[model samples]
Target: MHTLAQLRAGQLAGIQRLQLSCGLTEFPPEIFDLADTLEILDLSDNALSTLPDDLPRLTRLRVIFCSANRFTVLPAVLGACPGLTMVGFKSNQIREVPAASLPPQLRWLILTDNRVEELPAAIGACTQLQKLMLAGNRLRALPPQLASCTRLELLRIAANQLEELPDWLLGMPRLSWLAYAGNPFSAADEQAADAATSIAGIPWERLQIGQKLGEGASGVIHQAVLQQTGGQQDVAIKLFKGAVTSDGLPRCEMTAFVNSGDHPNLIPVLGEVLGHPDGVHGCVMPLIDPGFGNLAGPPSLESCTRDTYPADKRFSVDELFGIACGIVSAARHLHQRGIMHGDLYGHNILHCGRGRSLLGDFGAASLFAPDGPHAAALQRLEVRAFGLLLEELMERCDLPAATQASLTALQAQCVSADVGARPSLEEAERLINSLRA
Candidate 1:
């Protein structure tokens, strides 16, 4: 065992790993001398502003954790570490990403909760990258070169300033998972109101709140009937609770749902209103005829698991394939329009009967610019989520042999740890269509 003072000496020749967590602010310069044999370093929760210049000497280093620091810029020598693969720099004061500063072997880059407004175009050059997390930033756009990263798998770019998404996002052959909520452009009008404010527009006799649909992080959803309307339309209304104490604005999750708008596979928004004084944010959406519960709900997951083994008692393989295809098609449509469904899961997808499936709950969606750093990150995250969903479906026991084989192969390709190995929405659609035929 190494003595406490000897480990602090920074001259320990055989030291391969070092962890300094508490009671330290700055790293001594002499620490760089051990770079030759060091493979891992943990210096999180410090007040570090910069790294030593001679860090590149650690040719064998592979992982570095430097989260919760005061770094405005990355160390210049990080890119020089030839064997480096993973780097964590979350909760920092970073403003920009310099392309030339990243190492070629980098595979995982986590930069969440930073002040970064832009990314280097050279990021796409790192073809080996897999998981890239850029949540809680100020980025307004993404770079087109991102499509070149054929190996990327998981990406999370939630909470940015994006306004629209690039068209090529849907064309990425390997992407599957993503989440990009809390963007200004994607904020819906309904999400801007509160409970009292939403009901102010329509008279009480005209609206009748029905069964409780579900509850979200900040509000509750209910099935409603508009008696005053000549057509007697059935609608879904979400009532915002008293969570917005800071600025009186609706929560980010509520905004994502209202902004999604109308689609055959989506719950169409009829109107939005805000009740006064109480400040209730509510949205009116066309209700599904039979009111199919979400797949992620307890009932659905339990049913699927219980019916897995007995092929005769399980849901038909054709029905499962049809549902998957509908999901992919809806995702493609949303991506083509520059929208990212940040929170995609079985629970968010609702069956509309007759081989029709609707992608509901846009409470986590965002619109990003076509060629901005934010969009690139959002697309990558979506690819990762898609892979996970596919994996879940394949594990179901009741699926037919042929359908299971095809789906398993597709899921394997989409969920590859390498982000670039996942299939694009278009490719997934094609594969689903072929299976249907």
Candidate 2:
């Protein structure tokens, strides 16, 4: 957020990052003054269309973000950066990503919400690649060469025109998080069974909304009070903001929440919201336990695929097993109900010190018949994600070698390259339960 005045006056020097949003229509040549020290540049939320040809002058530059801009093509100069590894051009008008636009060491790339109908085969050359985000685009097919990226982990390709997923999509060894909702080959758009049968509909007027609890791409969660007919009771409310989210549609999220059924480790959906002003969509949910907090933060620029936790945090072996058991049990139940909790990750999990935990957030969920051909692959895909989470938890546990050996063996089974070789969620749960005996 440094201002142009500070930069011009040399008030900012030897800084490694610079973010400006003054709506410049051209590149700021003044940036070169700190080129010797700058490692990251962010010019998002501006009217800029291109970068200077000598952008490589910043020899230490490694990450660049120009999202929400007016670029029709990825600036070719990005390819010349000696150390660049991450690039983002989200919500732009980009239609062309030249074969030469990618840097050699590129690891994470984001091109969400663009007009990209295709990706260049050159993308396969970046062997260091890990995370990729390409949601909300016109892509009909992904470059098959992407299959060569054995290290790729997190990927988002939702809201596209693909008729079918590539065969290799289910084979990536390190892949864990994946979102392909809103595509042709995906299951037909799903509608929840009559929600009234499972949960009541509460009038919005009868509830008092409070301060925001949290928010994500799909909606805002608020602490609320259910003005009961007899008295008042505390509750949680999720008021969805309509539009295409980074994941997909909010209505789809609502449908998934309503139909997810019930489980002890799942946040209870008390009812659907009714009579919202201006027809806003929402749901009534139980207030989460105050003792519970998110297990980890979302991925970072460097750890593009893994969750980040506090360095001081550590868990006992019993606590780790309890958390793992609760999550795997919930996942097995969801799979039985024909629901895919697509955004399963450490960030989406909450837990108390004693290993009491809940798996929440249905924004990336989708419906599929458990008997369908793709069902097996889908569940195994999530098993890999769970395995990664388990590995993380185990790494922080002060457990003995004998206990660690067994859990690591199970994780190895879950992340095996042969998707079909991965155990079913139910089987994985059973194995986890056995570990505690």
Instruction: Pick the TM-score winner.
Output: 2
* Whole-model lDDT per candidate: 0.65, 0.85
TM-score of 2: 0.93
Please give the clash total of every predicted structure, in order. 54, 0
The sequence of per-residue lDDT tens digits that candidate 2 reaches over residues 1-437 is: 98888988998899999999888799888899998899989999999998999999999999999999999999889999969999999889999999788998899998988888998999888888898888788889989999888888778887788888776887787777777777776646363233333558899889998989888656889999999878998998988866556676666676667777878888878888999987988888988878888888888887877889999879888889889999999988988887788888888888888988899888777766788777888788899999988989988988788878888899999889878888888888998898887
* RMSD of candidate 1 to true structure, Å: 10.7
User: Which ten-residue region of model 1 has the weakest summed lDDT?
Assistant: 298-307
- Give me the runs in candidate 1 sitting further than 4 Å from their true place: 1-6, 9-18, 29-38, 188-250, 254-388, 392-400, 406-437
Residue 281 local lDDT, model 2: 83
lDDT of 1 by residue, 1-437 (tens): 33336666644767887766664566765557676677888788878888776677777888887988888986657888888888888878988677756889887787877888988888888888766777778789878788777756446666678776566655555554455555565444223422213222444446688899788634578888877545786777777664331112245544444444455677666666545346676667677766575655421212411112334323355656667788877777776656777656766777643456778766545555445555544555575566666665556537667877888888777666555566777898899899878
Q: TM-score of every model?
A: 0.54, 0.93
Question: What lDDT score is found at residue 50 in candidate 2?
Answer: 84
